[model samples]
Target: MAVAAPQTSEGQPPKIKASAASLIDVGSGQIYFQKEGDKRREPASLTKIMTAILAIEKGDLKDVVTVRKRAAAVSMGQDIGLKSGDKLYLEDLLKAALMYSANDSTVAIGEHIAGEHDLFVKMMNDKAKSLGMKNTNFANTNGFHHPNHYTTANDLAILTSYALQNETFAKIVSTEEAVITWLPDEESKSVTENGEEKPLKQRTIHSTNRLLRSDYQGINGVKTGTTPRAGNCLVASAAREGRQLAVVILNSNNRWNDATRLLDYGFKEVRPVVLAEKDELVTELEVREGLEKRVSLVALERLEVYVPRIEVEKIQRKVVLTPAPEAPVKRGDKLGKMKFYLDDKELGAVDLVANQDVDRLSWFKRLFDKS
Candidate 1:
């Protein structure tokens, strides 16, 4: 299902120059602004974010992978200088792919994880479909300008939201600098010391995303991409005062500036408000043939919504129940629904459940009790 774009309570949305762009509040999964967000465009190196996340999920970070000739031959992009037969841990490759945007590292990761380039690309497409990124497809792992390889700003934002939840992926993308060691080159390995292998080669890599280097407050990172076909693209995220926001821009010359503006607008315009607290008693339900005349119902979890300050007054909660549940109701059994709404639009709903079990009244007790 697609998430609806959020509308402002007052005033017009901030203008952006990107062909496709989106801004979303992380905590509430609310879209603050969107322009052609569903339009498909090349993702460039930003595709590595998906590759990195899948690698993390499928294998151990410390697992070593031997670089293949094909992996080192990713066409039309920069590599981390991996050579055939070079061995490195998956964690190091992830650092290179994310921090340096090295296409070869991603290829190595793809091959290591899926055993073939085509299979890995298939997995990428499968994951995209599972994440509800309907407009995305993957022809290759490193995102080297294939006609079949494309994604939309909205789809990229969805992928980023899922990736950011992984602590390892978040740490790798946010890193500004990292150093990784690889096996010595053939020439270096040919000359050993005292009939033993020499030390490995270490290289330092820096992030290609400029926002992480600049003084933009709380600019944690997501990713950056550039290609002749895609122009400049970036997925950016930041956290402030326990709230986080993510921005996506595709095919924009002013991606950084536009993303910052969108983020600024979201932080200033959207405010997070608690609609209901976890286990808060909403209402009591009349029990039929239960030992207890009434049973309490409570919210399963805290419900929070992000809305414009002016629309906060319009927020409301509705409790809906089934025909009075018969006795023998177990705690945590779903009895009703608690729906949160902003004006006429429904935000979300949670199950309202019985707080404690209520047993059916005994026949003897029922017979003796005459109203």
Candidate 2:
């Protein structure tokens, strides 16, 4: 594939066209590149991604949700034709909201999770803040047109990072299509306002993420959105070989094309490189007081980093040990940090914990610990 023209005099900065975008390596959990990425902008339907994540994590998929009047009132964009009292499973609503961009389904999930859209929006902000998305704010769950429902591409990426870690969230985000059928036990049969109500039968919801159906292989699920103010936005993920990566595009003329381009760049330049190995002694330091020898530290998470192949030489790692404790040591107690440096810049680091806990020296052992 053709690359964007370089931006720096050192070389080309890869010709990538996007309104606001971020490409990250999931395996390494690194933001490889960004452009207009931190600027706050309207999110539109991208809000459903977080809604899906929260629902899949906390709400029961099989539980039925009775559509409420508030949710039905949101009929501007795509909707699942929800009536005031029609019952659908949490899973179906999730698919409808995520796959079909159904505003009704989005509201259903939001209200079910927190019992109110306003309250759930608070949860969304709280969750976003917890994920370090300082530039994000939520006005509603369905991402409907609102003046204050805004977020940055980078903040959305941070939220995606947290969501992708959850298997259920990953599954829902990655799902391309779902065929939903009512449970045999659904008690109340509801009517459709369009003069027809099928008996909660099978209905298919196609994923809004066109990448799921496109040339990009190993694609996990994600969400797509568009609005007059937001244009086209997407948070897409794909796996290549063994590693996975997520790309977030906030506003683009060609959302699908931009997402694919970003992903291609990730696979080519921002390739996954192991940053740390499990059980590998990353940092070793002296023990304050212990029955055994000096304590060694290891990474809690495998140090994986994604960087441009050209920049690999620029990537250097150094293990930084915390100050030695002054007293008795216990196994598995955190004592230091393992820092991976890139071109003298700290790229990322994981906590270093005591690989093996040590027992305090007994009274007799302390006296004899002269050696």
Candidate 3:
């Protein structure tokens, strides 16, 4: 079988899947390579990722939400069989929406968060715009097919970057399966919904993400989506040897295969090398009028770098350290920044932390400290 060569026009490298995509180096906010990552495409249930985040941020998990007609309206895609007027807690609804891609759960969660479906959709678009997702829009929280509901692979990646900041949101998304049990009714005397609480046993829920399963190593929670127009999309992350990587793929025919390819590429082709370790001093700052002559400065967080191993030798790296003046500096002050560069391009920056407290110099010491 003859393998097709890359198409070229004016002596340029053949175009890869510009319509496909990936994003890596999560912490440093670096994009190794991408295809039509910014191209507008259907998000499918991956829209639930944003819905989950919004619920986490704006809705109280303990709050009660009586499923409304709109919430229980006949919808399409993944569902948890919610009925009209069904009573459930915010937490359960969130789990359902995220794990099962329940359209009802999405509507219910949206209502609970933004007080209405329309408003919740607005927030989704607003957040997308704020994240610089210039080519995205949201008409519903459930990600059902709509003429206007659209998002890009890069936009999804950006959303993941912000969504992971919420620790709880991050945990729930990555969970393989969760058993969610709640009282059929918050009160025994309360009207029964879902055929009574029935002794309140754990109802197990499994994660759609296989990476979080025991079979896979270093894989954690993220989101996945598929639609006729969007194909298969995934925003996934994994941690190995003290390094974490987030990968996003869009417009793929084979969802799992694309995810595997991107993740394998990250681990094999562009694993994050430890440019600097936590608490490792990259430089020192001279204390002008403090008890110590100098203060050690180190990276606040572990510095893991992601780059193509094939380009490892060619991947030039440099650290720019900005040390703060020592005098009157409090312990743990964010005095400076550590910037790591690869191949003349600024890859990322981490906040440099002060090693210790620097007390104000005494009158006598202040006058003679410079001497």
Candidate 4:
């Protein structure tokens, strides 16, 4: 089935049935498809994605946390088998929280990080604000239903993109299954025949995201959520040939189907095209009063952008250079700018820089040349 991406001025997008959905080209930050993307709704366990990322950032993985009573008492339907007084590393707790949608584990992480779950919720909201998630708010760390707790598909997509930039967060969500070992408490570390501490017990769990295990190509991680209010929701990421896409679906009966369809459509409908390559000579401009008669201008950085596959040829390029830059120009001197547009609307721009240094002519030579 086809899912409509955002309608470009040049082409029509396909139609989709999800209540709220968004698809982005992860590499170029291009919105391929979106339907009510900014409308807020309960995110369910998908809230744990933000929780996991924060824990990874603020806590040391090796630190062992003694599970608190409140953490073990989260609202039902999910758990990491955590009990009050049980000890587990921060890393293991995060693994359980993200992969298994473990509400208890998520609470344990929140409590450990903020000394209380409510405080951690504040942190989530604060981070959301800082990340420009205007439509997002958090009332709990584990996504237990609270009318105040909500996020939008667009916000979740933004969160996923930011979290994936952290290697640790990305690695954790991408994991299909992980063996979490809980460090035994002092009470449980009774002396054996040799009087040595017993090895920690291990529990293996699989990711809640079935796309990771399915035949879907390049499926990585992200998360899935379900609640009476939110229905089935999913934030999924996939990559091919170095190009990546993130899809978010909220309140959908066919979340998996919708997410996969959006990704499949994105790869076919839009692709990244290099507008300008770094250090590639763009234009040669006359250099006034320099050792050399001319200087080559080049792009200071690579300029790659995403465009609808069919409209790649329609992109317009304009070079705007500084008016007559006098020489003794340095190799990296900013000389001008390259602006890109589609249908007269600006897409992006990059700096044009000097390709190489050009020293001024000696005084004697300058005088002789002038004569």
Instruction: List the candidates' TM-scores in order.
Output: 0.80, 0.75, 0.69, 0.80
> Between the candidate structures 3 and 4, which one is better when assessed by TM-score?
4
Instruction: Determine which window of 10 residues in candidate 2 has minimal summed lDDT.
Output: 3-12
Q: How accurate is candidate 3 locally (lDDT)?
A: 0.71
Extract clashing residue pairs from model 3: 18-36, 174-221, 176-207, 177-205, 177-206, 178-205, 184-197, 272-305, 287-326
- lDDT per prediction? 0.85, 0.76, 0.71, 0.84
**For model 1, the run of ten residues with the poorest summed lDDT:** 1-10
The predicted structure with the larger lDDT, 2 or 3, is: 2
Output candidate 2 Cα RMSD.
Answer: 6.3
Please give, for residues 1-371, the per-residue lDDT of candidate 4 as tens digits. Answer: 23333433334444555799998766556566789988888899989988988988899999898899998776597787777888999999998988888989988999999998889989999999998889999998878889899999888888888888788888888999899887877666755798887656778899989889888888888888988888988999998988888998898887877888778778777767899898888998788789888889989999888777766888999999887767689888888999999878577899988888999988888889889
The sequence of per-residue lDDT tens digits that candidate 1 reaches over residues 1-371 is 11123343464456777888988776656676678978889999999989999999999999889999998776557787888888999999999998889989998999999998889999999999998899999998877888899998888888888888899998988999998888665666744666887548888999888888776768898888989999888999998888889999888977877777777767777777788888999899998889998899999988777776766777787889988988989999888999988656688887889999999989877767754
lDDT of 1: 0.85
lDDT at residue 152 of model 1 (Cα atoms): 89
Worst 10 residues of 4 by lDDT: 1-10
Error of 1 at 357 (Å): 11
TM-score, prediction 3 = 0.69
